[model samples]
Target: MSAVTFVSNPIHEGWTLTHTGGDAPSVVERATVPAQVPGSVPLDLDRAGLLADGPREDGTAADWMAWCEWRYATEFAATPATPGERVDVVFDGLDTVAAVRLNDIEIARTKNMHRSYRFDVRELVQGGANTLTVDFVSALAYARGIDADARHGDVSRAYRGVRKMAWGFGPFGGPPAHTAGIWGGVRIERWRVARLDEVRPLVTLDGDSGRVQVHVRVERASGEPLTVYATVAGAEASAQIPPGEVTGVVTVEAPHVEAWWPHGHGPARLYDLVVDLHSTDERLDTHVRRIGFRSAVLTGAVNVADAGVESPETPQVSPRTEQVSVTVNGRPLDLRVERWMPLDTVLARIAAEDVRARVEEQRDAGVGVLHVDGVGVYESPAFYETCDELGMFVVQDPPFVGDGYRAGAPVQGEAIEETREHVARLAPHPSLLTYGTVEDRAYGSLVSGIIAVLDHDRLTT
Candidate 1:
């Protein structure tokens, strides 16, 4: 990577190019710390990084691609005056869609507007000032054209699929035809991560024995043989994890286990789990997770044909498909009532605090399961982590609304990749249960393929 410079204009410093702008005007500030790198340069409302723009006349899909490239190039900052530390570039909204690149290296991307994307930039960034750019693009023309087509309205999936576009929404209205720019924040930060990259410590009861299944994933760059150890509810176990992507399973049986209860009953007792990754005898990373020992399973489908709504003929599936709930410690609890609201509003205004508060509120209300409708945006990693912490179960579905039902080779590939990413992010969470089927459409073998990506070890319906 070449040396990057912060400038008012889109200037070239060595091999790095820098530019910045936002939904509003801002000042030209120096990139004094890592957190200010993304939106470090001052930006305007021009359609530079936008994939497509317009008053709607001659905009094409090609325009959208160009706009996406530009949005990826734009710069953003977490704070103008950032402390020197482990910086995290967090993307609340990249408009309808975008991929974030740091110093010419691709870091993250999101197709749904309702999700928050974050990238760890500690390694990519160095001491002193650095150049950060945000390339935001628009989805106006594609969104509008898809909405207006006669054929687009023919199927249930068509209307449902458009929900993920996340362009036409909010107080400021939708993206302009062909207009694409960074509509969200480019924040850099002094962030924190537990020593482990991935930690999965599960507690379960089988027959008369209580077990804790432990799995840990260390950071690849650590470049050291890790000593994996865990202490759950005061019980400890240790194992040696040699270097190069280690995957080891250690099971601990608790002879006297106290079960976790459902909402409105007894309080859920969370056991303290300490996972440490060590090099030789020195600890390289340590993560602490409050884990609760619980067992849950979806009982049955309620109102599969028609939710509460009544119709004349045999009503097939509507929005309310399953009566989803979880059973904990022999008690059944109805999950939270939620609809798949499009990612438009939330994605338009990306804020970590806002996302955290929303999830916390849901948990406080005793909501354990969130049935996410496919007609809206996908949840972000930050959102999922909050769910994991709050013990919220997520039922995920790939975008499959309208005539655009993805199947066969192309869609299956996409779904497999999506499953890999989703499972990698949320598999450790005890709250996460089922990986739902596609909405309103089904591809015979595709279901098996998707399950194989993540839950291959278990048998399912």
Candidate 2:
């Protein structure tokens, strides 16, 4: 048994709930205390922790619910037989907005509640006397506007019926559980370091010959030159790269190199491409990435009816007729789709346990693409990394939509900067396929102009 603890607050729907199996209700009932503790501040005073004018503690006030604030810390033993070299601290989520301080150093934050968030603090901490502090601010009360109650009575009833019709449970089915708290799994993990910051293996086929480009980026801290090696289809090649830049191009002549096909016809022969970056006699990092020597382009026209698989009854509509789809080389593929809403302030107030379950469910469903919509704010990088390895494509839009009165003028430069920050953080993923223009027509033009000026390698319009 290791010396760590599990602490969480999960609010499902309007109810405060716990995720610890059959013991959750009992645990919450025993943990409620009104007295404030030292170093733990109340998010709101005067009202005595009540949020949105909910029911009072005595249950006399109508619609009473505790303001989503809790100053609590608990510990759990570390799991035995861990997999990595160092322990990594991961926070699955903390509502819509959270400030996480590990041993007094602020480490993470989240703006969207729709996705689970995480942080790996292996380098930030060491053994003995580790302190973790997380402040989760709720967005639930505001999210009430988007909840079903805001709709017409009959429509809301129909929505509930549809949910029961489909999944046997409506959206509003509970007491407020842990709304704004550490709601997901928090753990210390271990993993080995990669020699290179990034490794991209590019394979291109033309008639009879295949071209391979081993593009790599090694960190300056890893002070060493690397001999990069690759093995594919019983063919082998090596190239020497200096410490700073490790870009190399190699050619292979394989008349029978099997090509991959999309969704139909012959099998998608995925050849194993292993890249090893070695320093003199020592192996530094071994990175593996799938390289499809094929071409994929948008096929359909940009029209509403052609939009891929969106629910027809949704209030939102895609303006373009051509819903985005990919065809590898000449074959069309029917890829699964997953949509992402921004982790807004309202969502941050919700429980992280609910968020984690949703993420796992989507992953379990074999969602192939994640369309991060523009309405919500940017999500944590954990979501992106999951999509990258899970074989999911990501279509990211700048987190701005609608035409406010202040359009053409420079209104919120910070918002644009925030969007740019999100793009920079997640753009390196191989799964990221497209960048949607901001909602405003003029803003789209501005974003395109900015990308053209900054990133000249790819075409963006």
lDDT, each prediction: 0.47, 0.44
lDDT of 2 by residue, 14-71 (tens): 2122221112223232343332111111221212443334433322222212234343
**RMSD of model 1 against the true structure:** 9.9
**TM-score for all predictions?**
0.59, 0.49
Which stretch of 10 consecutive residues in model 2 shows the poorest summed lDDT?
160-169
lDDT of 1 at 273: 71
lDDT of 2 at 63: 20
Name the runs in model 2 displaced over 4 angstroms: 1-96, 104-124, 139-194, 200-214, 220-222, 230-241, 244-256, 299-302, 305-400, 403-434, 440-460
Q: Model 2 RMSD to the real structure?
A: 11.9
Sliding window of 10 residues with minimal summed lDDT for model 1: 1-10
